[model samples]
Target: MAARPEPMTPTGGRLAIIAGGGRLPHHVAEAAREAGEDPFIIPLTGEADGDWTGFDHEPLFVGDFAGVTRAFRARGVDRVVLSGGVRRRPDWRGIRPTIPFLFRMPRVVSTLLKGGDDTVLKMVIDLIESAGARVVGVQDILPSLLAETGPIGAVSPDDAALADIRAASEAATALGRLDIGQGAIAVGGRVVALEGPEGTDAMLARVAGLKAEGRISARRRGVLVKLCKPQQDVRADLPSVGPATIENAHAAGLAGVVVEAGRALVLDRRAVIGTADRLGLFLAGIERETMA
Candidate 1:
């Protein structure tokens, strides 16, 4: 059985939510606000988009790597609630990098290329902390958002689907280690889709089409697996699942989801699990090493 995480206790301090695109960032920001913490949001250019003013925190655009650090400093951010999709690649083209960022880019990119996600992001966290701030989990400030363990829904995979789940889990973790992709969809023990820059929904939708076109051969529904890259810095980001994940899985005719336990997050746990249950999607989390 997967462990059910407890709701977070409110830790007081102004939390700077450095947000990027995706539901998780917004979820964290909302969770922080509901906890009565002073929530500030900084939207990374090309990543986070929404009504900034409604969040009740001033939104600043930080593009270059150096600008991000300065943005936090300017807002008196002592602790940060790091959340959502800050692209590792997409933001590079147009960035007007500050001098500091340019000087550090070689080291950062070198780490990314030669090391795992953990290696690359740890360098980043080190950079942030060196600038006199702390980086903490979304759960630290938003405990209720942690994903709980259990069967989320009624419909689990049939025997063949379970096989696919197992295979998908293995492949997904391997890919994560290589920094290839976080998610992979498999049918009949073969990879049908591996998540690319377009994200999970796109991956699922495309694989569903492939299955319809007779490219995949699973007798039952497909299986989807997302993983935290092995050696990833847990403090910064982990692969996440939520209501949206389960919904997308079902739409793609998938039977279940497998994420790295403790290393992955389930946002809106109750609603996500309940929806998965209602939709007959199996939800499971695993440790990265053991599962791999």
Candidate 2:
């Protein structure tokens, strides 16, 4: 077995969480607090959950680039974590760019218009780092959330399901290589669905529709595969799944879900496992080499 990477040590400085959406930001905050590091949350308005009352938090719009930088400097934050989801692109008209943003405005605009999601994310990371704060991956603070290799829950994929897993994985990786999306579904060794901008849930919903329409054989189940994009910056935007994912896969009549071990986040793992078990669905985490 390959050795797990060492957990990152807390910086001991105030940690700022650039909250987006979903339960991930909350998980990261709890993990940071448990590590004895003070956590300050800077939630992106509309995207972030409003349950961050106890922590030192401020709600700021995602377009407010100036405000975010100022918050980090004012709060004495040295380390930052960008967590959760942000489905909508920021409206540029609403933003009040800081001097740094202004200085890099040309490059930023060019990247936003011409580059893919990964390029845009890399630019965002560059912007944050240029502002004198270190951006850390969510896995660094919440290593336990990293999906473990092999099968999870009571159900395991059968040989046919495994074949579908491999097929779906190849499709998903091909999509990732193009910086398109991170998920794909396969039935009976044939690709059935590919995730687009609508995301995994929506992709599964489409598969469910196909299954209902008799396009897919009701007796033959499939697998959903999600993994990091090839050449993706691992420090941000790793693929994730939770209880809802399992429920959706079950609804779509998928036999299992496969993720990249040590590279994907398993949100609410206990609940996810329980749901998978109850639904008789397998959740497997395969190593990157297997996918390769």
Candidate 3:
């Protein structure tokens, strides 16, 4: 396991959210507001799908490192929280960096062209820090979003589901160690699907397709497991689940869903639990230490 960076204090200076598509960013913004801090949102153009009405924000392209730096300086932003889903990586040849970023462009290009998601995120964090802003995870701003150990709702995993969880959890951890992805699915104690660059929803869709085609056994349902990568910088890119996840899991014909306890985020907790319970599926937060 990798040592996580010490959490940065949320106090002092203006806070900014480098937003992407999904409800997580909105949740962070709302939490910041509830804490009496007005968050400035920098929604990535073409990537941020949520409505930003009434929130102070500016839109920027994903490759516009220079623009992001300028925004940070202009807004006096010293604390940044990265949230939501970024489906696209910038086109290397099209990146237009300036000033300090101009000097770092070579290294940035190398990492973007050669690195995995985790490496890319680390590079982004370094850039944010270089601009004098400390990067924090969504969990830091709203600890309530962190998934706790045990069942999340009315249902608990059966023995068969537990076995699938164990198999999938190990597979997820292994996949993360390689910086491949954070999710996997197992059926009857056998790994059946792995999340890739395309992400969790798409992966679940693939499982659904397999089940529909009669590839996966209709009688033996599976389980989806998500965990933080062994060497991940938990300050960013932690595995997350939400109502959509439960819906997809049900659609995928899975028996349950499991995530690393205290190390994953559950977006819209009530909705997630309600969806799981309503759909007759289990949602569990399992500690990695107990997986063995």
Clashes of each: 6, 0, 0
Cα-based lDDT for every prediction: 0.70, 0.88, 0.89
Backbone clashes in model 2, listed as residue pairs: none
Error of 1 at 156 (Å): 3.9
Q: lDDT per residue, candidate 3, 154-260, as tens digits?
A: 99999999899989989998999999999999988999999999899999999999989998887899999999999999888889999999999999899889988
TM-score of each: 0.81, 0.96, 0.95
Q: Model 1 lDDT vs. the true structure?
A: 0.70
Off by over 4 Å in 3: 1-10
Using lDDT, give the best candidate's number.
3
Q: lDDT by residue for model 1 over 36-135, one digit each (tens)? A: 7667787776678776777645444533555666776666777776687766542345445566567777776567557654565677677667666788
How would you encode candidate 2's per-residue C-alpha lDDT over 1-292 as one tens digit per residue?
3235666677746789999999999999998888888899988888997588889999998767788888888988888899999887665566678876788877777777777778888888888887789998999899888888889788899999989988998998899999889999999999989998898999999999999999988799999999899899988999999999999999999998999988999999999999999999999899867765
Pitting candidate 1 against candidate 2, the one with the higher TM-score is 2
- Of models 1 and 2, which has the larger lDDT? 2
The ten-residue window of minimal lDDT in model 2 covers 1-10
Question: Candidate 1, 78: how far from true, in Å?
Answer: 1.5
